[model samples]
Target chain A: MAREKRRWVAYGLTVPSYLWLAVTVFLPLIVMLYFSFLSKMPFGTAEPVLTLKHYKSFLDRDFYHFLTWRSVKLGFHVTFFCLIIGFPAAYILARKVHGRWREAILLLIVLPFWSNTLIRIFAWTMVLRTNGLVDQMVHAIIPGAPSVGILYSYPAIVIGLVHSFIPYMILTCYISLQAIEDSMIEAGRVLGASSLSIFWRIILPLSLPGVVVGVVLIFVPVVGAFMEPRILGGRQSIMLGTVIEDQFTEVFNWPLGAALSFILLAIVMAIFAACYPLLRNRMKLT
Target chain B: MTRWIAYGRRIVGMMAGLAMLGATSVAVADEVRVLNWKGWGTDEAWAVAEFEKQTGTKVVHDYITSFPETFTKLRTNPGYYDIVVLNAAFVEKAAREGLIQAVDPAMVANSADLYPDMRDTPQLNFDGKVWGIAWVWGGTSVTYDTEVFKTPPTSLDVLWDPAHADRVCWRDNAEDSVRFAALALGQNPDQPEDLDAIREKLRALKPQVKAFWKSGDEWLKLVAAKECDLSIVWTNNTEAAAVQDNLPVSFIVAKQGAVAFRDGLAMPTNPPNAKGAYAFMNYLISKEFYAGWVKIGGAPVSANSKAVEELPDSSLTRQVLTQPDAIKRLNFKGPLSDEERQTYLDLWQETKAYFAE
Candidate 1:
C-alpha cells in the first residue's frame, strides 16, 4: 500500500509539468498541423475544406527549393565562422590562461549579450557601410583605399550572425575543455608526441562534444533567423525563413506558413538523426 | 508538514491579492483599446495623454509591424478593439470582413475640411459606407543625394543607372516593389498588365541596389552615412533627413510618378466602449491634432486641407504637400485581391532570388 501511494505521489508531481508542456508546446504544434492541411482560413463566414495543397506548394514550386538552399548555406557559413573564431579563443583561455584572468576574459566574451540582439545587428550597419567607421579608418591608414562597403550583403549577414551566436560556441567548448585532466596532456607529451599531434589526438577529440552542441545550438536558429538576414542581407534577404514569415505576417496564408514550418522542423530533425550516432558515441546521450 | 501547508496557503493568498489588484485597476478606468503601428500619430504619447485628460477615458494601444498581422489580430480576437489604424487600402477589406464598422463622415466635426483626394477615395469607402477617417497621407517615391545629383533626376530609371550602382536602396516590401516597378514600366501600378516584365526589370536592377531598407529610420541612416546616393523612400523620411537633419538628400516625384498612401482611423465592430471610441476618433481627426503632429515631422503629412494651412510656408510639410504637380502625379496603389497579391508576392520573391543567384 505504501509503494502504491508513493507511486501515485510521484505521478502527481509529474502530471502538472506534463500538463504544462501539453498546453504550451504540443497543443500549438497540433493546431499548426491542422491548419497546414486546410484549404483556407476558417475564420468568420468563410468555409474551408481539408486539403494537401499547402504541402503541395512546397513540392510544386522551385522558389521554396532555392530559398531552402540559401538558408542552409547561411547556416553553414555562420557555423564555420563561429568555429574558427571561437575555438582558438576558447582553447587559449581554457588551457593557457589561469585564475581571475580566464574569468575576466570569459565575461568579456559574453558581455555583448547584455545588449539586445537587434541593437548589435544595427550597430554593424554603422561599421560596415560606405564611409562608415570601417571605411574612415581604412582610408586614414591606407591613404585613399577604396571604401569597405560590405553592409547589406551576404558577408554582412554572416558577420552579424557570427557576432550574435559565437558566444555559444565559446562557452560550450570552454566547459568541455575544463573537464579534461592535465595529466592526459602531460602523458601525451611524455610519450614524445609533438604539441600539434598532442592537440590533434588528445585535446580536439575530447572537447568535440561541446563543439557539437554549440554547432547544433547555433545552426538551428541561424537557419531560421529572419531579422539578421533581413536587416543585413538587403536585397538578398529572402530566405526560407523570411518567406515563411511573409506568408503569415504579410500574406495571411496561415496554411502555407504552417506547412513551411513543418518542412523546416522535419529538415532539422533529419539532420539531428544523422548526427545522433556520432553524438551518442561522444556525449552521454546514449 | 503542517508548516509547509501554512506556507502554501500564504503563497495562494498573495497571488489572489495580486489578481485582485489587477482587476480593480481595470475597473477604475474606462479604456479605449486602439490597435496601430507603435508611436504612429494615433498612439503618440502626447496625443494619448491629451485625450485621456480631456475625456476621462484611458487609452491603451496594441501594435502591429505589418498590415496582415493587423488583420490577423482583429480576426483572432474580436470585440477586443475600439479603434484600428489601417492604411486606406486596407479599410475596404477590413469592413467587408466586419472587423470594423462604418461611420457617416458628417459625424466627425473636422471631416468638412479633409482633402477630397485623400478622404473621398474608393479605398476608404465601400458598400455605401465611409469605413475609415483619412488621417494622414504621404508619397513613397525617389529620394536622391543633392550632393551627387546637381539636377533632380526625373525618371524612375535612375535607380538602374550604373553611376548609382552599389549606391541605390529600395524598400524591402514585396507589394511596394511590385507597385513601384509597375509604375516605372508605365503600366497601371494599381493593376499591372504584365508582371513578367516587371520581374525581369527588378532582377536586372538588383545589381545596382546597395540595400533593401525595411524602415524609414534605416533609410536615413544609410543616406546619412553616404551608403545610398539614390533610394526609394517615404516623403516624410526624406523631409526629415533634408529639412531637419541637414542631410543632402532631396525628395522628388519622378516623371513617371510616385506611390501615394493614406493611413486612417476606423471603429472596430462591437467595441466595448463605443462612446469612448467615437470621442477618440473625433480627436484624431481634429485640426489641432493634425497640425501638432505635422510640426514634429515624425508623422506623415496631414490629410486635412485645413490643417495644412496652419503650417508656415517654410515648413517642409507645407511646401512638399501643397504642390499641385506632385499631387497630380501621385499614383495611389489600390487594394489587391488575395490571388492578385499572392501573384505579385511570388514574382517579387522570385525576382529577389534571381538577384541572389
Candidate 2:
C-alpha cells in the first residue's frame, strides 16, 4: 500500500512534464503528419482531400533526393570533425587538468553555449570575408597574398557548424572521462601495458558512451540546420533543411514541407536505430 | 513533506492569480500592433512617441524579416495585429483571403497627397476598393563596386558577363531572380511566354554567381568585404553601403530596366483596434513624417507628392525620389497567377539544383 502511494507521487510529479511534451512536441508532430497526407491546405476555400501527392513529390523529384543525401553527408562530416577535435580536448580536461584550473578550462570550453548562436555565426563572416581579419592577417605576413575570403563557401558552413556544436561533444566526453578513476590507468601501466595500449584498451572503451551521446546530439540538429548554411554557405548550401524551409516560407507549401520534415525525422531515427547496439554496449560498460 | 506540498500549492495559486491579473491588464490597454519588415517601421522613434502622446493609443511594432512570415503570423494569430505593412503585390491576395480589409478612405487624411501613379495603381486596389495605402517605394537595381568597374554596368547582362565570373551575387528569391533573368533575355518578365528560354538563361548565368544573398545586410557585407564585385540589390541597400558604411559602390538601373516595388500599410480584417490602426496609418504618410523617414529609413522615395517636393534637390534621397525617367523605366512586377507562380518556383528549384552541381 505504501509502495503504491509512492509510485503515484512519482507519476504525479512527472505528469506535468509529459503533458507539456504532448502539447508542444507530440501534438504538432501528429498535426504535421496529418498535413503531410493532405492534398492542399485545409485553410481558406480549399477542400481538403487525403492524398499521397506530397510524399509522391519527394519520390518524383531527384533534387529532393540530392538534398537529402547532402544533408546526411553534412551530418557525417560535422560529427566526424567534432569527435576528432573534441575527444582530445575533453580527455586533457578530464585527466591532465587538476584543481580550480580544470573548472576554469571546462567553463571556457562550454562558454559558447551561453551566447547567442546566430550572432556567433555572423561574427565568423566578418572574420572570413575578403579584406576581413583573416585576409588582413595573411596579407600582413606575406604582403600581397591572394584573397583568403572563405565566407559563402562550403568550408565556412562546416567551420561554423563545428564551432557551434563542438561544445556539446566536449561537455559529454568530459563528464564520462572524468568518471574514469586514476587507479585504472595506473593499474594498466603496472600490468606492462604501453601508453598507447592503455588508451586504446581502457580510455577509449570507457568514453565510448560519451562519444556516442555527443555524436547523436550534434548529428541530429546539424542535419536539420538551415540558418547556418544559408548565412555561411551562401549559394553553395542546398541542404534538405533549407529546401524544407523554402516550401513553408517561400513556396507556401506546408504539406510538402511537412512531408519533407517527416522524411528527415525518419532518417535521423533510422541512424539512431542502426547505432543502438553499439550505444547499448557502451552504456552497459559505463 | 506535507508542509512543503502545501507551500508549493500556495505558490502555484498565487502565480495563476498574477497571470490572470497580467492578462486582464493587457486586455484593458489601448494599443495598436503594427507588423512590418525589420527596420521598415516608422522612421523616427520620436514619431511613434508623438502618435502615442496625441492619441492615448500606444503603437507597438512587430518586425519580421520576410513577407511570408507576415502571412504566417497573421494567419496563425488572427485579430492579434491591427496594421500590417506589405508589398503592394500581396494586397489583393491578402484582401481576398480576408487577412486584411478594404481601406476606408475617410480614415486616411493624407490620401489626397499621394502620388497619382501610386495612389491609383491597380496593384493597391481590387474590386473598386483600396486595400492598402502606398507608404514607401524603391527600385531593385544592380549595385557594383566602383573600384572593380571603371564605368558603371549599363545592362543586366553584366550578371552574365564572364569577366565577373564567380564575383557576382543575386538575391535568392524565386520571383526576383526569374524576373531579372527574363529581363536579361529581353522577354517580358511579368508574363513570360516561354519559361524554358528563361530557365536556360538563368542556368547559363549560374557560373557567374558567387552567392545568392537572402538579406540586405548580407548583400552589404558581401560588397563591403569585396567578396563580391557585383550584386542585384535594392537601391536603399546600396545607399546604406555607400553613405553609412563608406563602401565604394554605385547603384545603377540596368538599360533593360529594374524592378520597382512599393510597400504599404493595410488594416487586418476585424482588427482589435481599428481606430488606433487608422491613426497610425495616417501618421505614417503625413508630410511632417516624410522628411525624417527619407533621412533615417534610407527609403528612396515617398508616395506622398508633398513629401517629395519638400526634400532638397541636391540630396541623394531627393535625386532618387524625383527621377521620373528611372520610374518610367522600372518594370513594376505584380502578383502572378497561381500557375505562373508554381512554374517559376519549379524553375527556380531547377536553377538552384543546377548551380549546386
Candidate 3:
C-alpha cells in the first residue's frame, strides 16, 4: 500500500508539466495532423470529411518550396554569422580574460536580454528607422551620401534575430572553451606549434559540441521566425513562419496551417537525424 | 452521540437556508455583465447608474482588446457575458455556431430608434433574424505625413511609384492588407470573385512596401521615426494616434477606395440578466446618447441623417479615411463564402512570398 501511494504521489508530481505539454505541444500537434488530411469548409471551418486536399494544395504550389528554401538559407546565414563572431568572442573571454573582469564582461554581454523581447525588437526598429540614429550618423559621416536606413529590409531582420540569439551561441562556446584544460593548448605549443596552430589543432576541435548545440538552438527557431521578418522585413522577405501563421489566424484554414507546421517539423527532424551521425564522428575524432 | 447528530442536522438546515437566499438573488436579475470591444461598451458607471434609476438593474462591463480574443472567450465561456459586440464577419459565424442568442425586437424597444440603414445592415441580421445591433462603421485608407510630402498623394498609385518604393507601410492584418493592395492595384476585391489577376498585381507591388505595422503603438512609432512616409491605416487608429500623440499625420481616402467596416452589439446564447441587457441597449441608441458619442469620435449609426450634421467637426474629420461619397465608390465587405475567402488569403500569402523574393 505504501509503495502504491508513493507511486501515485510521484505521478501526481509530474502531472503539471505533462498537462502543460499535452495542452500546448502534443495536443496541438495531434489536432494539426488530423486537420492536415482534411478538406477546407466553405465558411473557413474545417470539414469533418477526411481528404488530403490541404496536403495536395501545399504540394501543388512552388511557393511553399521557395519559402522553405529561403528560410533554410536565412537560418544558415544567422548560424554562420553567429558562429564566426561568437566563437572568437567566447575564446577571448574564456581563455584570455582573468578573474572579475571576465565575469563583468560576460554579464555586460548578456545584460540587454533582461528586457522584454518585443521591446528589444521595437528598440531595433527605432535605431534602424529613417532619420533615426543610424541614418543620422551616416549623413554626418558622408555629407552627401544618400541615407541608407536599415529599416524594413532582410538585413535588418537578420540583425535583430542575430542580436537576440547571439548570447546563446556565445555562452555555449564559452562553456566548451572553458572545459578544455590550459595544459592541452600549452602541450600543443610545446610541441613546436605556433599560437595559431595550437588554437586550430586543440581549441577548434574541442569546441564542436558547443557549436552543434548553439547551431540547433538558433537555427530551428530562426527558420520558423515570423515576427522579426514581418515587422522589420519589407515585402521581399517573407519567411516560413508567416505562411504557417496565415493558415491559422486570417485564413481560418487550421488544417492547412497544421500541415505547414508539420512540414516544418519534419524538415527540422530530418536535419537533426542527418546531422547525428556526422556529429558523432566529429565528437569521436576530436 | 445523539447531541452531535442533532447539531449536524441543524448545520445542514442552515446551509439550505443560505442556498435559498443565493437562488433568490439570481432570480432577482440584479446585475448584467457585458463583454464587448475596447471602446463600444456602455459607459459602465453611467450605465449602472441609469439602469439603477430606471429598471433597478446593475451593469458590469468587461472589455476585450482584440476581436480574436473576444471570439475565443465567448465560445469558451458562453455564460460569462450577458451581451457582446461582434463585427459582421463574426456575427454569422457566432450565430451559426449558436454562440449568441437571437435578439427579440420586442425586448429591445429602441431597436426601432436605430436608423433604417443601420437596422438592416448585414452586421445585425443574419438571415432575417436580428443577431446584433450596428453601433459604428468606418473605412480603411492611406494615412501619410503631410509635412514630408508637399501635396500628400491622393491616389493609391502613389504607393506603387518607384520614387516611393520602400517608403510605404501597410497593415499587418492579412484580410484588410490583401484587400487594400487589391483595391490599390485597381481590382475590386469585394465585388469580383475572380482574384487571380488581383493577386498578381498585389504580388508585384510587394517590393515598394517598407513595413507591416501590427499595432497602433507601432504605427505611431513608425510615423514619428519617419521610417515610413505613407501607410494604409484605419481611421480610428490614425485619428486616435494623431490626436493623442500630436503626430504630423493625416489620413486620406485612397483613389481606389478601401474596405468599410462595422461592429455591433449582440446578446449571448444564455444571459444572466436578459431584461437589463435590453434596457441598456435601449438607452444606448437614444439620439442624445448617440450624438454625444459620435462627437467624441464614436461613429454612431446616423439613424436620423440630421444626427450626423449635429456632430461638430473636430479638426480630425477633414482627414478621415474616406468621405461618405468616397465610400460609395468602394467595395462593401459583404458575405464571403469560406472557399472564396480562403482563395483570397492564399493569394495574400502568395503575394507576400512574391514581395519576400
The best candidate in terms of lDDT: 1
* Model 3 interface DockQ: 0.23
Comparing only chain B with the true structure, the TM-scores of all models are 0.88, 0.87, 0.76
Each model's TM-score? 0.90, 0.90, 0.83
Ranking by lDDT: 1, 2, 3
lDDT of 3 by residue, B248-307 (tens): 777777667867776677888888778778877776655655555555552433443434
Interface RMSD of each: 9.6, 9.3, 12.4
Provide the clashing-pair count of each candidate structure. Answer: 0, 0, 7
Evaluate residue A120 in candidate 2 and report its C-alpha lDDT on the 0 to 100 scale.
Answer: 97
Measured by TM-score, the strongest candidate is 2
Instruction: In model 2, state the lDDT of residue B123.
Output: 81
DockQ of each: 0.36, 0.30, 0.23
The stretch of ten residues in a row with the least summed lDDT in candidate 3 chain B is: B3-12
Fnat of candidate 1? 0.66
**Candidate number with the higher DockQ (1 or 2):** 1
Q: Which runs in model 3 stand beyond 4 Å of their true positions?
A: A1-28, A40-47, B1-74, B89-93, B105-113, B126-128, B148-154, B181-188, B254-256, B279-310, B318-324
